[model samples]
Target: MQVLFGYNTNGGQSVQSYGYYDPNYANDIRTVMVAVVAQSHVQTPQQDAPTKLQLIPAVPASQSITGESLPAVYFYPPAGSHNAQFTVMTTTVPVMNMIWH
Candidate 1:
């Protein structure tokens, strides 16, 4: 599995983003999980200090039969969720793991 990261600057708000993973083989199946965490200093006053990572939302999973390039799966941090960092974890069994930004 592979991961890519960038920012979306079209139209409205620009968002920090990342995506696109294709299995090694044409018939292979894989699942990708994505999450974002706010930088410590970005936490709001009402929010508790985050001691652990939090899940954002699931990126569209990928399945390809023709081995053709799969559609790009992109994820963005919530609006106003500033100073945020993103993570994408990929595994065969739908589990969360380490991903570098």
Candidate 2:
């Protein structure tokens, strides 16, 4: 197995993932993917809890796709998740060995 993709966020409020590809680019390969999420805890007095609630904000989510045939990966801020994705590593033949758009 070979590493083919990697992604991350600015802070721990989002998820991160890594992808592994197989040597056989012509056919599909099976592999397992995993993700771990961590959050911090703060201690505050009962009186301060109400006022401090506004300090925390809901995080926006994002998505990523490695290739057209691949599935989209959704990122939920703060907590992370994982999923399996199938991708093709082969390239199409080019007449001039180049691509335009």
Tens-place lDDT digits, model 1, residues 1-101: 23332223232222223244333221222233443333443555554432333343233333223223335544445566544443445432322223211
Which residue runs does candidate 2 get wrong by more than 4 Å? 1-30, 42-68, 78-101
Q: List the global CA lDDT of all models.
A: 0.35, 0.27
Judge candidate 2 against the unseen true structure and give its global Cα lDDT, from 0 to 1: 0.27
Which lDDT tens digits does candidate 2 get at residues 1-101?
A: 11223233232222243233433321222222333333235433332222111211222233222323333333333222122222223222212212111
Best by TM-score: 1
Off by over 4 Å in 1: 1-63, 66-68, 94-101
| Residue-pair clashes, model 2 | 1
**Which 10 consecutive residues of model 1 have the lowest summed lDDT?**
92-101
The alpha-carbon deviation from the true structure for residue 12 of candidate 2, after best TM-score superposition, in angstroms, is 38
